[model samples]
Target: MQKELNLCWNFGCFYSWSKTLGCNLTMQVQRLESGDFDLRNRQLQFSTFQIINVVRRESIEIGYWTAKQGIFRNLNQDVSAHTYLHPMPDLNPVVWPGQTHIVPKGWQIPTNGKKLQVGVRTSGYPEFMKVERDPVTNAITATGYALDVFEEAIKKLPYAVPYEYVSFDTLGVNYGSYNDFVYQVPLGVYDAAIGDITIRHNRTSYADFTLPYTESGIAMIVPVKDNTNKNTWIFLKPLTGDLWFASIAFLIYTGIVIWLLERRIRNAELTGSFFHQLGTAISFSFFADRERVDGILARLVVAVWVFVLLIITSSYTANLSSMLTVQKLQPTETDVHELLKRGEHVGNGGSSSYVRELLEQLGFERSKIRAYTNPDDFADALDKGSKNGGIAAAIHEVPYIKLFLAKHCKGYTMVGPIYKSEGFGFAFPKRSPLVDDFSRAILKITEADAIIQIEKKWIGDEHACKNDETIISPSSLNFKSFSGLFLVTGVASTSALLITLVMFLYKNKHKMGINIGHDHVQRGHGTELETERIQESTADSNILHRMIQMTTPASKR
Candidate 1:
């Protein structure tokens, strides 16, 4: 069969082939002889090459060789022998021809010397990670505690590994959340992600996380209410129940001692009805300078008791005054279980959807949960409260809540249970060796107190919650606080009673006859004379006589 040959025309060219194969043709074409070159009589020449049964398209090269050039001429020996190409037919149908993307293991420093593309969250959590863009130049600046830690960690590496931050918003119009941002690492969109991105179990399926650098837990924040107006028994709050009982008991004891001492001295004012005597005794204890004491022991007891009373009263007054004047800020709500049971609406901020899931897990109805994107939204929602179309409380991670409280520290406070979490961490592709390095670096920085300095730099000491709800509420005075005073008063009262008894017995020894085993004659006469003398003295003293007469009513007289 004479199949037509594929021919080409050239200004001056020729070819010679020694052998040819059918269907798959392999030919050796040689260059023209030296004498074949004619410059003046230039004419077009043509050459032919043929292959039978051309079933598939492929690349084949047809080139002329000269004696001066010595190089590999075998067609099958070199793949580059054929520069011009053809499409090869599919020989294996089982294999997929589409290319699958290869994710690089970013644990190693890139050999290409390109900066690692680190993705950062753009909105919310400004204390941990903030992304700012210049209005005119569109330049991005990533800062805050998270960024500071990340840069410091990079410096700890043995080899220099450069990185740049690319900002994205989880609450953007695209409705992306923090989980989506973390997935970017495995998708080869980012080499790493840093921010207040919490390390969670579900996210580990797509990416890996380094050890947590900050405190881990979700907390609730609510507006603080000034309870100074709401507390009705504020006066009673200054002293505990035990303290009150102890004080009253001491007051009564001191008064009884004073009245008994005055009665022993025949101070007729102490002589009255049972009820009248009780009233007289109480007045002597509390009402200062109400009555005068004659006995030295009574005076000493009263002086010590009075000192105790002065200290107790002063402390109570000072504490009560403080409670009444200072702003007693307290969280509007403190229990998460109560919030769940009441079905009160709660709000959450930032791009973390896990918070909603967590609320649901904690027995909160999904409909009762509201999501907020920014701090302002969170504040506004909390201020409105559940009854008024706002959330009753705002739930968020501790770091974010702290930042919020720092800014809104005046009327807001953190409360409720802190749900445990992994805290904030940097993310990378799965099994990234860089995870260990960064985790170790984090441990070092934390141990060295570098993280604290970084935290202070970004969050600042001034931004901390100054008016903590727990600290703002004044504690009541307990019995332990006044135990020393109670001891001193009790000792004085006991000693004065013993001394007074001793003095009375000594004064009456003459009437009783102190001689052992000897009975004195005229004991009755002696007692009678002593009694008469006492009556004569009582009647002679104008102060004693008037006191007795005034105490005695007209009907009694």
Candidate 2:
């Protein structure tokens, strides 16, 4: 025995111990086949001792000694005081001083001993967990996203953890909810619940949840419209109704204003019925042939009005062409709030704890929501919409909804931004030591792309959903986008109109005999010239009289 022990310690050979007279000591090593120069190799261990006394415990005699540590300093020390004792100090090097994670002294967990109990869902959710019956034992075999992630996280742990997945069932009935599945951990029915268990506030009050490894949120899935322009009226789409009305009103207004300024002039082109004048003004916008405007004021109005018409017509042509060539499929409801206001039926995954409460909190009544169990329900909800007794949309966590879309990739799609959630996490009993360990390991697993690998393995083929019918939504021109440019044009036109008005009044002032009188008429101009001047003055005065008559009421006149 001594010879084998010497060889084992020196050359890492097999060794055995046999009973010998007065030789009861046994040695242990820190590691097997350690390098000769390894500092940890300086270890020789003896089984520890614990002396318990049933009666007269204080009178017990105990001697603690080690070649490296030394004997107990106070042999006369009360033995009863050593109820909770530690091994004698040794010369072996202390590892990771102060950084040692003290196992929470409650439960003694064998690092690689007992098989860990993992609870899983048995309803066969593919993205989170899916269980199958083994052909031989008929035992449920678990697999999928959550199972993969759990396995990956365990592998990333510093030590191997033996585990067996047991599906949650009662009397051979499958689990009713993920919440109940999570409760199994706190109930001691499971060491951990491994599935897509959402990290909810209420659940976290009692259960420990690891940091989410998947993105968190609820989103809406709806059927994509097959025809983009099914409900649209094509002709009226070029300009909004409000803009169309305003354009027509301005066209007539330009005609009236121009007639008032030019009607008194001898060479005026406004000598026509009011309808004719309006038609002419409106036609200028369409680039129709027309006579030249007679006066500066008339020309100024025409030029500015024509420029405005050019812009309006150009915008109309471009929009008309787009609406005709492309298609516009606007979403019926873009947000949860909009759906709530419309009282549209909305579907939810069968057993999510937050879906109903979240909708209720957002002000939707409970009856407005429909709960769906599988793909058929989802398809019915979309195929028949709310008015036909089906839901307008189905809302579920993004992961589940993504799986659903991938399978039924033909006409369905997930829409709407996600509402915030904490996501799916591993659940353990509150304050379990594994929580931090699992969370840290999760970071590493995700960083090393193992999570991505697992997800791709399960869902890589699910991306076959492609749709050529995606709506090409044409951006409607809002008034604000063009308001600044229109404002500049408007201001320029008004300034020109005002200048022309001032000049027209100033030039016609003397003809009206308002700025000058007959007493100031030149005497050198004789009878014939005086006659012509009086006749011209009378004619000009008559025009002023007609203008006043047209503007005033009979009582004021």
Backbone N/Cα/C clashes per model:
0, 0
lDDT of 2 at 350: 69
Model 1: lDDT to the true structure:
0.71
Q: Every model's Cα RMSD, please? A: 22.2, 16.5
Give the alpha carbon lDDT tens digit for every residue of 116-139 in model 2: 888888543555677776779868
lDDT of each: 0.71, 0.64
Candidate 1 structure quality by residue, lDDT tens digits, 112-194: 44688888876566677778778897777988889889999988875556677777752252536788888889989888999
lDDT of 2 at 466: 57
